[model samples]
Target: MSGITRRSGLLLGGAALLSAAAGAPDRPWAEWDVAVIGAGVTGLSAARNLADHGLRVVVLEARDRIGGQLYTDHGFTSVPVELGAGLIHGAAASTWELVDWAGAETVRVRSEPRAAPGTSVDGAAPPREDESAADYLRRLGVPESDWPPVSDENEPLSRWSAAWMVERGEFDWWSAPRADFRVVGGYDRLLAPLAYGLRIDLGRRVRAVRWSGGGVELVVSGPGGTERVRARRCVATLPIRVLRAADVAFDPPLPAAHRDAIAALDATDAVKLLMEFDRPVLPADADTLAWDGDLDVWSVSRLSPTAPEVVSVWAAGEAARALLALPEDDRFDAGLRALGEAAGQAPPDPVRRTTHDWTRDPHSRGAYLYVPPGAHDAPAALAAPVGGVLFFAGEATTGENTVEGAYDSGYDATDGLLADL
Candidate 1:
């Protein structure tokens, strides 16, 4: 009880198990079977799957709202705005099931993938065992004009592992781009079914995790105060930056494998700049465009023909850092200038503009992890369970750097956890 005083706390926000900080250990939390940290799609999917198997699962989330990096901005414009992950990357993406369940409207993004479907990397030879995406593009003889879209999307693709791309089925972007889509109702609607009947504790920021073969303990702090929660097993779906920042400590230290994997991945400086245009900016048939600069401009109307003429400009790496460093008043101008430059004309000023710098947000350290070349196996190593007590699931755990990848990781971790037990 002596050490418990300094860290004494009670579970906060929605989970009704623990009653008081001092007496929480002896309370109803003892009945909890699993503790899932971070209520993003990864945690939600795991919790949902566990509950379906008749397990008592409690989800602890740091933010007041759900969706870690998959936030939808309803107030940004008359139509839903995606500040985070926006597209379903492939026809085989697992998110389509959730989309159907949510009944969300979606439209195919206009793209001529590799000139036709079922081709092999635009008909070029397969990437070598140790090839980078940048090299692959060069090998394909992709025109410099066409490289902007791919280059701007993944700045410094010299770090993108070609094998990792094949594993993620992302080579299809050039091999098959017609399958991408945007959710008109927003990606958040898929949460309803994933979260049904789950006891999610929002605002519970887990600061430390202490686990052993006996069970696992988590020290979480929230608005009310701090508290400890115990469960037979735990799943941590924290973002790569959060773990790398050591925001949450692990008792006895994590193994060298996890530590090395942690160092292998890093967060990209990513930002989304949304501006409302009086009229369309890109060509009528164009679904997306890469400006001369590092920004990729696309009309929101592609999500729905009736959607407003708002165009969202996306930038990553150096461009995002530049945009984030700009003064509040100058950022929008930079986006407008990029669009105007790419479209070859300066149009009327945007009626309104909105931009969110997730890089600067404390709750979310950054957007997500990007796998550097030669470290393609980092996600698998990071996800490897520790002492049969701690499991990790996030966008980083999956080879992909997208929401669907995150969603797949959630259930994948759940399947692994079930097998472990």
Candidate 2:
């Protein structure tokens, strides 16, 4: 099958299913060929692919909106400001394909500044073999007093895999500059297409999944009330943080191997603080800045060439936790102060400011997944299907921990389900 309209696919698939169950006893709940949990990139891509194959699929999203981490806040500024996932990463990324399909305008960020020979950031010595980048920097004769207040204490160096870095087009953590890109309208423009012609039920929080029987049953709480949904196959695309937290109980509980995979992986914190200025306040020459202070990275960019000036402050790992611990208004103030200090200019505060603490979001819990030391195969293990009844797909399962990986994992899940069927 090529492309199927939402109405046509629903009508045809429903009629076929009813005909097949004509002689069976009437069931209280509605049945679906496939039930996808979470309307993120992974779930939406899987639902779209399965629907294209003539399967009746329904996506249940706990959030009120469709694009999960691909959220764009129009209220903050006249131009769309991304509160979640922002950059497209690289040209090879699958997100670029969607951008091309949508004909969205994109701007490739300037590459990172190259380090001089035999030196790291701030003229520090290069990393040694088998040494973590963080430890190597600490040992590079840099004074302890010069170090940023936020140390990389809880963050592990092994989390930064070479393959992952390469995929992101970054050759070295301290030196190699990566070329990043962003969508003109918003990252949601690329995601909105994948959700087209697919049944997505927003504000549907999945509380439990009972899959011991022939079919899978899902207990979902939504705006109306709690309801049970039955499906022959179920694809669970919940974030690793949510899964690790055991937010949704599974009947017969997952096997020891699955549980082990969930425990082995790590979900790190990341917070994006967006500040919109009434006028251009940041330096035009610098598109991005990596500070050696409280704020790890500060990126300044425009929604369009002529759009209002906006600065995004990103903090990861322990720094993220520190910022997330503060109250919402305090967090914004801290970020604004940091931006001004870094730019060496007092930022004009005539406009709006916003931020999203992914670590605090109930549905996601954390930003994304990371492969912990000695858990190289954890992603594949987590992605593996359980008794052909429960399938898993997410950024963690893909091992890429990117929007592209999440989108690709959906196709991977659909292929696996189709093979089983």
For 105-133, candidate 2 gives per-residue lDDT tens digits of: 88766546333233224433434434443
lDDT of 1 by residue, 276-353 (tens): 876777788887774557887777755556667888878888888888899967888888888888778885788888
Best by TM-score: 1
Candidate 2 yields a Cα-based lDDT of 0.71
lDDT of 2 at 196: 58
Supply candidate 1's per-residue lDDT for 18.
Answer: 17
What are the C-alpha RMSDs, in order, of all predicted structures?
A: 8.9, 7.6
Clashing pairs in 1: 9-226, 9-227, 10-227
TM-score of 1: 0.84
